[model samples]
Target: MSKVSLPRHVHRVVSRGREYFYYQERRGTLHAGERIRLPNDPQTPEFWNAVRQAQGTFGPTPTDTIGALIDAFEVSWATRQRKISKGTQEHYRRYLKPARKAWGDLPARELRPRHVDALIRKIGADKPGAANNILDALKAMVSWANGPVELLTHDPTQGVERFSKGEGHRPWTSQQLAFAEQVFTGTIRRFFFLSRYTGQRISDVVRLSPNDVDDGGFSLPQKKTGVKPWCPIFPELEAEMVTWERRPGPYLLQSSGKSAGKPFSTNQMWKAFDRERKKYSVLSGAVPHGLRANAVIRLRGEGYTALQISDMVGMSVEMVESYSRHADRKASGQAVLREFQERDASQIVKRLESGKRK
Candidate 1:
């Protein structure tokens, strides 16, 4: 077999918005360009179509330099991740869309620090956490692209700023839970109770089926972490799920139609929760995921060990500490801490009377 001669090294670069570096060999001539304008996303199909039209214009399978490819990677990454949840995906797309418009055609080796900084700054402005998320995903994409062609010697994200945790995890009181119970019905009620109990993410729980309940407990494969989340079910929840299962439906809530169907979208599920929350008139701005934090706070007050809580909730120990600062008390329906403490002031009055007698 004859070996194909390796093509001359086309210059590679990391992508900087509006610019990047590139090296080219044309008819035995070598040249370099930085931050060359390529097609933005709006111009992508046309640009690539032009590439196909100009296929042999450069050479076979002519591709953008490393800098440009990184932008391509971000676009693909953003699109795929968006399918994870409509609203969540939209948040990522908001950044990647403009980013692709800015850096879509540069070579990989041309990417610059400022380009990364600009994108991060943009996302961090309105949504700080999303900024960090996109940054991390881009770092992985660059790492993969760099290794294939050695375009970059160092990772751009090493110095990127991450989002802060903000005061603490969002918490919901037991009274909030009671109101939610009143508001949501049928499978949704079951789903809400389970969220409060297991702290499994709504994204994770909405897909659950009766078969997931097995061997005296339920096992769920967490979407984000890809770990088996097996926990003993509450006797009441288990019974409720059984009754719900006897009725015709593939999901505990809504996703597919009849036995065969598409899964419930994350946005749809959340919208439903909002409708119910409004109907009950309990609290505003309380999201489904906050139930996880509420459960952690509740269990912590009950004096449950963080390790034990983590086991039940299918979260990592670090995540457990990050969520629960304390043990074994329910946060779902408790009165406000300030009010509850004030209600107990009679103890201090009794001690004062004893001192007066002495």
Candidate 2:
């Protein structure tokens, strides 16, 4: 078994042969007491985003104190208007709790990069990843307080050194896709298909509603990017989606058992998805979110441009290119072969003419 490094304040426990991870402060619970279960096995991009988004470093000495500024920022448009996800808000609260105890009474205007640097070192000693996460939250807070009536004139987190966060999750392979599709059944199989075709994270995928479907396409904002793009339902996917019998609820994916037919929370959704995923003898690094990579690669192979892929998947061109490199390599090789074939045909004809002349 490989060693796993969790974020600051996060602990892991294995119960009944399953692993669960979460953040806990000495006093208060993180995320308003909502348990955030970190992804198991191969940590994907979505899992890293959830980890980096949740850790942060608090409350009220004065209106101009750092704590006060964080309070104000939390209620600002970014949080209130859903610019960030629910997991992000919980992270803000979790980190701020400790911050309040440390510097809640300090004036925000007096803060300097050196002060933030010291705090980062203290946290990084335990978990460098969470140190960066906390730094990100402070940076956001200070930026939010840049108005005429704001608390600070300069952002203290500007020059703070960020600990290195490694390259995130790996992409899924064609073999892994085939194995998963073969093993997964019923709702799990539907989820596998939906994610592959739609290029959506499981978080957003679980919340999909029957009403979100239409003649145009599937309409929904991406949870990570906050961009809403219409995805055309291809014949293969449309047939499956159209035939799905949604429970008597708004969510397209519903839970089984005592909570049968109810919508799945973020934790519940991933846990259930993982439960089914673990049963398969698939690739070690395979993850559900890698379906996004599958979609991008498949589309590129079918001659879809990067911009078209971006629009369909609600990702930037850079992201699409990263996942479609395999397809690009194949296309390049095919182009080279075509050129060789054309040149060889002309040379063959010339040789035949020369032989006839002789």
Candidate 3:
């Protein structure tokens, strides 16, 4: 039953199957909220352009449909996937899943700042870290949706402070590291050693090879950033990693002839790493990712600066900001300062004694 009815507004976006419907009201056109149907045929990309065009013409988009906004966000996200990494794409997808309205559609032009704030608050109540992750993703959507509007304009997630640190990385203790090293060998060693050395993501480590490791240094592109770059290996791990062969197909670390040739799925490698990590001590608390943080900790303790560590580990200063945030960093800092201060005091006392003797 296709009944011609004007619920409200000058233009209406009805997403029924492929054809989108929109009403038009222009200069020398009818009154405010006069019904006009614009083309939404998928064949004509102008249909999308027309909708984008309409916003510039109007003062404020009428209290638009919330359902329509959610759909628009999905479309914008798909467009962005062309330029970003797969990891980022998956992250945005997770955020978009919860952003759907109760009716399964949200209009872009109708969202208010309060709506975003409330969503952030609700997510925060559920889990603080997740709340921030979702907020970042939601903000990307808000930015796209704000292209139009004359007045009553407010961007959501604006002025909304993001969540700060909670707990820090749970790196393995020296004993745990020793114990794991003693018990593990072969392919497991390759995986474990790379984690200890390169501070690479598990996905990157498993895919690493002799070609990636050269002259006691390993270099590869980050799967997450899609950046092709190289990072040096820890001297201790480098000696072993440099000898491995680069396979034509998948992994650097191999189990046997068959599984060795193909790459391990992310989940598969995670499960395998978990088994190895748990074997030493439950207290090690080192996940596949925790190993990367541990490497950073070791590097910093050995007098590496943030920039040096970022370059060596193939991360941005911003992304590796988490690395500098260990609870022990402050404690470690104080200890180093105290040691130097005591050394200075001792030297001063020695000079005074020598002067008195003279």
Candidate 4:
């Protein structure tokens, strides 16, 4: 291959007769020692786009600014410590994109609670969920910068508050579940059954395969919490699984389209689920995460304690109780009524015996 002239800051090296390009900042620059690999062919648009992005990201960011702090924090969070999960990192990046654009040039020390409050209000005006997500991302970044990184002296998000997210993802009622059973079939039904029975988040549910199943139950480490729990196969779920045709990859694969044979992404699964859910007015309020609550409620109704349910579902006992609040209340009411009836019957028997003796 002939030598192709590369752009400034872009270097090319030959290894085993193959060429690879990399973007490395010049010495004594604001972002010195920063290196990012570029695409092989400089003639393609992808190569230029990658170069542009690398330059913008690893370029000369102003010192002591929010952008610089965020850039450093992201590098440390992603590369050094790597405590954050990939899914969570992607989630934080979604919110951080807008924040970076809005306050990138702002001095890190100048950030205040008032500024955060204003940003939340503006973002929350239309989308409270988005505002809350952004607030959380900001809080995490600020906390990291304040604590270990020592980029900021004081916390700007100390008094900052997130927008109120109303009662999120209401649990599916028995009637709704029955309706769903009648309406959804095949892949969609499998998705529903896995989510409802396993009580796993959609992220985990979509990735489940037949191999994950054993004599005991589904064995997998949860993506978000990193808890590996053996989710026992319920009778209902077991019956449903018997009907499913086992596939190579994920149990739930994309049936059709260009992505067929590939596992369904979380967003794709949500859209598919929502489409089926919206067809029936009865399931209008039901969401995917609500199935987790349904599992908790079902377990509680089956006489499982919160601790037991927590162990089974890889959730905290507090969270299990939170999800099964209505079930707990009903169980408590039933127990009280039973105790009262037993006491009344015992008193009546004692009175009859006393009357006979008199």
Measured by TM-score, the strongest candidate is: 4
Candidate 3 achieves a global lDDT of 0.63
Q: TM-score for model 4?
A: 0.76
Mark the 10 consecutive residues where model 4 has the least summed lDDT.
73-82
Against the true structure, what is each candidate's TM-score? 0.64, 0.66, 0.68, 0.76
The count of backbone overlaps in candidate 2 is 3
Candidate RMSDs in order? 11.5, 13.7, 11.3, 7.9
User: Distance from true position, residue 107, model 4, in Å?
Assistant: 1.0
**What is the lDDT of every predicted structure here?**
0.60, 0.70, 0.63, 0.82
Task: Report the Cα lDDT for candidate 2.
Answer: 0.70
Model 2 clash pairs? Answer: 56-95, 57-95, 58-96
Mind giving the per-residue lDDT tens digits that candidate 2 earns over 147-246? 6545578878777899875433456777887787677667777777788888888877886776677675788876655777777777778777667775
**C-alpha displacement of 57 in model 4, angstroms?**
9.6
The stretch of ten residues in a row with the least summed lDDT in candidate 2 is: 53-62
Compare the candidates by lDDT and give the number of the best one: 4
Pick by TM-score: 1 or 2, better one: 2
lDDT of 4 by residue, 282-314 (tens): 987889999999998898998899888888898
Report the error of model 4 at residue 232, Å: 1.2
Scored against the true structure, residue 75 in model 2 reaches a CA lDDT of 46
